[model samples]
Target: MSNYQNFPPANEDGAASTQMFRAFVDEPAAQPPTAPNEGRRTGVIALSVIIALVVVAGVVYLAMK
Candidate 1:
């Protein structure tokens, strides 16, 4: 016998309760709107490019030593 069962109390057979339950279940769930991160992404890309450029310069300087 499976223990995972959800049988709501059979004693709760009121008309008002039934209507309230139906109304609750009929509504769509709300979702938060997503914000664009274009500026942040550009900033991160610029930082990565700067870091890569610095690493290449360091490597060239060491190689010339």
Candidate 2:
């Protein structure tokens, strides 16, 4: 009538398998690497602003003429 009598014997191999599965599940994920050229974005933004200013200036000059 006892619950332990109904269960089968524990295997050593099953214990090792469970430990490996738990370690794999609990491990933290790796972060992605940062870009080496992040500073280049500022240069691109400055270039875009300069181009926009030149276009605006050209339009103003034509209107004045």
Candidate 3:
């Protein structure tokens, strides 16, 4: 009754079209983290840590008031 349970069109022989329709199921991807990208990510992480420390120090100073 629902859309999920709706039957596909039938052929003249009464066979459902769904039998001919194959879902394009993909296999698991294989994109490993590359060294170049990892290097860039490490640089970003280092920069973020430095900026976070600066922000925390500033917040502590402001909160001290």
Candidate 4:
């Protein structure tokens, strides 16, 4: 039973536990300090925009014909 339930002893005041919980909850998720893929993301966005433009132009051309 003890092996299955190994855990740390609880704080007597409980304030520390509450503060730790609050700090953890309030903290923002960790993000990469630098966006190494930012350039790749921008390139993908540009390619998607270009593809969309080509599709729209093709539709317009078909409609005109």
The residue-level lDDT of candidate 2 at 35 comes to 88
Q: What lDDT tens digits, residue by residue, belong to model 2 across residues 4-57?
A: 654435655534787799899999998999987888998899999999999999
lDDT of 4 by residue, 1-65 (tens): 34686555664434478778889999999986998899999999999999999999999999999
Candidate 1: residue 56 Cα off by (Å): 0.1
lDDT of each: 0.87, 0.84, 0.72, 0.86
Query: How many residue pairs of model 2 clash at the backbone?
Result: 0
TM-score of each: 0.46, 0.46, 0.44, 0.50
After superposing candidate 4, which stretches have Cα over 4 Å from the reference?
Answer: 1-32
Cα lDDT tens digits, model 1, 1-65, are: 87998666787654568778888999888888765887899999999999999999999999999
Query: What's the lDDT of the predicted structure labeled candidate 1?
Result: 0.87
The TM-score of candidate 3 is 0.44
Which 10 consecutive residues of model 2 have the lowest summed lDDT?
Answer: 6-15
Higher-scoring candidate on lDDT, 1 or 2:
1
Q: What is the C-alpha RMSD of each candidate to the true structure, in Å?
A: 12.3, 6.4, 13.9, 11.4
Off by over 4 Å in 1: 1-35
lDDT of 3 by residue, 1-65 (tens): 65667554564434535434433234456797667687789999999999999999999999998
Better of 1 and 3 by TM-score: 1
Question: Could you tell me which 10 consecutive residues in candidate 4 have the lowest summed lDDT?
Answer: 6-15
Error of 1 at 14 (Å): 36
Q: How many steric overlaps does candidate 3 have?
A: 0
Candidate 3, residue 35: CA error in Å? 2.9
